[model samples]
Target: MLRWVILAVVVVVLAAGSTLLMNLSTSPGTSWNLPVTPAKAGPMPKAVVEGELTHEFGEMGQQQTGKKSWKLTNEGDADLQIWKGTSTCMCTVAKLQKEGDKLTLKPGESTDIDIEWKTNFVTGDFHKGANIETNDPDHPTFPLFVHGKINPPVVVIPGDTIDLGAINSDEPKTVFVAVYSPDRPETKITEINTSKPDYFKTDVESMSASELESGGLKAGNKINLHVQPGFPLGTMREEIVIHTDHPLRPEIKLTVVGSVSGPISVVPDRLRMVTVKSKEGASGEVRLLVRGGKEAHFDVAQKPEKLEVSVEPIDPVGAKGRYLMKVSVPKGTAPGLIDGEILLKSDLPGVAELKVPVSFLVGAN
Candidate 1:
């Protein structure tokens, strides 16, 4: 029995040692030779986007128009696929080529995405963004931006408000007001409208029906605004709304500022409400009475302020001769003056320098 046990122990030890040597020799970095293979190539290179991601137009005139192009290049070994392109605004139009539903680009090849946009709305700064989708595994999504400004539809060279300075009722004076779009080819005035129909009249240079439908007006196309100043004389105000077919300049407001030639005068040439305040952000009202002037058409403009200011037409109806104004200030307003002007627009005869003093003060919290 003892001889058998010793032989068994020796055999076990030898077997264990043999297995350990085999594993060590067969290890990856050990004596065992392994077949060599070429290194696996890194992931296919990705498509590279170049050129402008955004285009900007600053205050485009009524007839202003523009276009832009974006370039896409595939630097990878595999082909790049573009699914589709889209724009958020109707004024923007985008065009690109596609093979059926797929847009494919061969290695080292490039393509262009064209974008055209027009501002036919009112004058202001605008911002827009676009999205691009690709087959790139790493970067499947991309973004682009566009920014620009639309010039004020109507540019009153000297000022937005036409200051007729002053006028005489019996003189029958005529002021020649010129209205034109800066971007000649891109914009044209289609129609002219006034709030008060009987007080003003507009006529444009005659054009054939074909010319009117053919887009913008020709050079030297002129529109005349006829102002008939007939009244009790004081301060007169009216708004002239111009309709156009410009992408960015659809409609514009022209202000008529003037005074009638008469002895009647307003104490404050301009009334400006500086500020309004309240403890819990309350409300209030203000009343303004145009102390002096003959009968005339008068209207009030609610300016930018925390409190809502309104005007109520007084007892005498159809009074179209003087500056009889009333403004309502809201209650519970915080203590402070809101900054805003009481635009007393009129169609009197002379340069009416009427400045009305306006200030808002709130009660104790």
Candidate 2:
């Protein structure tokens, strides 16, 4: 009876150990060979605008500010990243509710973008634009536009720039501009000034009713600009400032852009010494003339080396000032280029100095 009892206990112990080992090796929660699940990708970002891309502000006035708003919506599954971009001009700017340059929008999110600009003294139609950069593949760059006409209290016909064209320094140039206040016609010219006092002078006259009617002005003045002959040679970019008694339009600047030709001039502006044999050398000449039959005294300075220069007065033909300048490079010169210039200094004001570039290229024999 003792042996049978012992054997039954041993068999029960062996069965319990085998069940525990099976559970440890093959449990669903602790499996060693389970398969890995792949991750699914989310949707891309989408940008949608609710209204038109352009805004019309009608007619705006000077010193006034204009503002427009646009709704930007993100119709996507993933987050939308938008970067702020530059506006059309410095006077115009775009702003958002947030302070940072980068803004994120979740799915089905929307925000407002505001564009503000100030009306300057310029007249006529104006168009401004701003850009919005987005991560959306379909819509990389979104453009917004604002356009309108600007009406100032004071009106200048033919715009703010007065082109004098080509001006001869020996003769005076005159141009006319009509300045008037459409609403307040009785605006008087209080004072006048200019950037170049020696070259610019101004005169104003009241516009006749018929004259005003022709120009579509209610009341204003016809400004006469008498540009004297003392302006320097080359190019002149000057300004004329006018002061009015009207409170709304007190001052306005008129730009004068022109090219002035002095009494002294030159032909074949640049002397081409070109390529020549080192043994043969090269030679050239330039014809110099003073317009209006005016006599000039020029002293040549800063002449290049390995060259000879001579200035001789030509025979007077029809009361014209003319001269012959001769430049010569002697034979047996080195195989190199002579890099220098001849600066002609004049005794007349405004015609101070003239530069002539010398390109003396020499080839080996």
Candidate 3:
């Protein structure tokens, strides 16, 4: 009986060991061959703007104004919060329908965003955009495009203003501007007037077919302007007014900006004779320089039939273009203000004539 009981106990132990090995190899929690279950994903916020991406304004003028609107909706189950709306250009303005400090839209809600553009002080093809900032993860930033072509009544070739930056006074420069109507092909320029006619030489001519094509127009007139020398030394600004036959735009104004540098410059253009010398006539010397970077030859012409003047080369043997002028007043001249001028006439094209003033303050010696 004892042997049988011992044998049975060993059989039970062997069975228990087999069960432990099977549990470790084939259990779902510890088995390496089992598939992993993925975690659940939550819903996300989505921003939706329904409309045309680009708003085009065809043939707009400076006097024209219009607005464009877009529908903004939150299609997702989460909240859609708009941070701000920013305009890319000064001529464009963007805002929400109901403006406030902060803007928020609930799920399934909609709102309108209006973008207004003013066609003032602009021309040619223009493109601008308005940026929308939101809390949507998919679309953090949205761009609204605005593009158009602005056609003015009259298109000024090159530009409305003529800028002849720093130029030598001895070199006359010429520029041409064409004025034509794209809307009205038969538009004509009746008259062209310059505020300072003495400074500018104007000539009018019809634009050729090739010239009109180059300016991207069907018809136009070419205005030739020659900037003359002898403008008062310093900065100069002038206006050119054009009279056209167009009913809406009858008059157009253009500006000319430039600075003239004198080729033949006189160091003290004015001579002040203070008093007569004790022994001899009051003598003074004036210097002249040729700034044209070339050989200069001139003849001195003095005013007042009796004024005594002498011209001498600064460097008699050198290649520099410089000269000195000596003037003397008679000792017995009467006491008063005697005004005179010394004129230098040269062969240079731009600096052909130059004048220097001379005055005598005759006092008792």
Q: Which candidate is the best by TM-score?
A: 3
> What lDDT, from 0 to 1, does candidate 2 have?
0.78
Where does model 2 exceed 4 Å of error?
1-60, 63-149, 246-249, 267-288, 291-295, 298-365
Worst lDDT run of 10 residues, candidate 2, spans: 90-99
For lDDT, candidate 1 versus 3, the one ahead is 3
The alpha-carbon RMSD values of the candidates against the true structure, listed in the order shown, are 13.8, 15.8, 13.3
Give the lDDT of residue 45 in candidate 3.
69
Ranking by lDDT: 2, 3, 1
Cα lDDT tens digits for candidate 3, 107-153: 99987866777666577887876777888878987787778887787
List, residue by residue over 216-315, the lDDT tens digit for candidate 2. 6667888999988756554566788889887877999888887767777767655876677889977898877877666677777768888877767787
Model 1 / residue 338 / CA error / Å: 26
Candidate ranking under TM-score, highest first, comes to 3, 1, 2
The per-residue C-alpha lDDT of model 2 at residue 290 equals 77
> Candidate 1 or 2, higher lDDT?
2
Q: Which stretches of model 1 miss by more than 4 angstroms?
A: 1-43, 57-66, 85-87, 90-101, 157-179, 185-235, 239-253, 257-365
lDDT of each: 0.58, 0.78, 0.74
Which candidate would rank higher by TM-score, 1 or 2?
1
